[model samples]
Target: MLLCPYNILHKAERRKLLHAIGRCLFSSWDSPVYFSDVVLADIFTSFAQVVGDVWLSLCMLLPGHSILKPHTGVGSRWILPTVMSLPYLIRLRQCVIEYNHQGNTHRRPLYNALKYASAFPAIYLSAAQGMVVGEGGAAATWFGGSHIFRLWLLAGMVNSLYSFWWDVTNDWGLDLLRPRSEAKKSESLRSPPRRLVLPGLHSATPHILQGSSSIDVHDPEGISRSVVELSVRKRCHALGLRHSLHFPLLVYPFVIFLNLVLRLTWSMKLFSVVNVNSHAGIANFCLKMAELFRRWMWVFIRVEWEMIKKSRESHTKHRADDGIDEYELIPSATIERTPN
Candidate 1:
């Protein structure tokens, strides 16, 4: 039976393959679950759905109204992104409910707030795009240039699409919510942990040692070690924090790059054809999203750093038994002479 590729596979292997297939399919439609991945996906899908809905609404409400007309002053862009973000935020809130049940009261509420806040920028950006296009028409009426308006609309659409893709694929936060399959859990348990060493903040020597059991102690101070240090000391053998950076690379860089492009496009425009109200709204939204992104990134980095630091500290504690001082791992600038 082992020789048959389909029938011979163990139950665990079958489950793993099934999960992988599910992931591949899900990623094609929705963003892969990672920390913040869902938020990113929601931003894009929500914006697209909103824009489409608004377009349909405008077509029905004002059949004779031309989006290209100079008098409209750029209709609401906030409607689409805001509308889209709301459902996803609600869903995210539901996800957090699970955490709340686990006694993570602080984290549950905090995540809910952050998810809600994330939608604001997407809405604002959509609004800005709409306003910019509308104001360009106004500018065209006064300045006698239609080409600029066309270019602005084209660029805005391109930027919006770019933003949409960013949200669809970049979902780092979602992975945190997904439960690992039994096969994965078993494989993880079986594999040996990898180690990493990092430079000490105060010393020239490589001070961080991360590996299994190095920082697994219950002490609070030990929890402050960096992830790299802990990994080297084998403390994270059971924690599985050493996955490849594939998910982040697949999602965040694209969003960041797209936002940068949009910003650059805005900066390159010589005249302000974008409406003030719309621009302010979109800017505010982008600012909020950026702020949340930064905060999440900071927390992830800090946590990893703490894990490493704890492992190193644990190593130092062990060394103390062999006559090494706590300061030995961290070298001092001034040396004291020993008296005979």
Candidate 2:
């Protein structure tokens, strides 16, 4: 928390900064929930990283204990995964709380919780691998046909794919699997999915703000259905166009590619084949740096997606106030609101 820039800001400034950060992390600016729950998860992860770094520093500073070697002992083998899993456990609990408290009509909250739950198997499997190698040594563990190695590989793959899918679909709002017609229907039928528009593209403000007859002050119901229809059409197309909204088009794809690569290999830190504490701890340093970069990209895209979603929701609400039945715009599901 000391490292976050929010510490230096005045109360008002801090509120603004926290709101933005909350959107990125939790997709909502519900202050109590964001500060108490979402921020707690992030803080736990930061502390875990700090603990790992401190451990590495100790390994380097006090070398007589053989702390720099692989299989340093039971404590060293288990500590990393234990610390790393703490944040996920916190997040998983939060998801369950939200699902129960708010009522899970769509089961979206449960699905989000499941994504966090997936991390545990990979994390523990890595620790198990380290423990096995400590007991049997690398030769027997790797070449002795140990099932742990293959099991760990399979667990890592499943965890990586699950996390990556959540990142792109739920977090980033890129429904890559749904067909184009499905995307169009989703956009038109329900309120537009919360999404960001590309930086260079036209603004995604509500039609009323753009000089469209979405609202006539004297007769708000006189809103042109055609105008609303056109707005929805543009928003549907903008979902794909906005992939590179904050950065250049090329930058987003590269970031996405890097995200996938990092996700797949994140468990490398736990692999017993190569000692992360060896080579002057270069492997540990590199992995930490890569993770930081991946998170930076994730935060950027996530905040943009949240901002767009908020905008679209506000627009929809304004229309509702003007006597427009937003649900009538499309033929399918009605927009439902979940309590914060």
Per-candidate Cα lDDT values, in order, are 0.41, 0.58
Among all windows of ten consecutive residues in candidate 1, which has the lowest summed lDDT? 267-276
Model 1 Cα lDDT, one tens digit per residue, 32-118: 333333334333333333343454456446756655432332344444444444544444544444344544454544444454444
Per TM-score, the best of the predicted structures is 2
Please give the distance, in angstroms, between residue 99's alpha carbon in candidate 2 and its true position after superposition.
1.4
TM-score of each: 0.29, 0.64
- lDDT tens string, model 2, 71-179? 3665676666766676677677667666775434678778988877877777677667656655656564544436766877888787678878777766776656456
Badly placed stretches (over 4 Å) of model 2 are 1-32, 35-50, 55-76, 137-145, 179-182, 189-248, 270-280, 323-340
RMSD values, in order shown: 15.8, 9.5
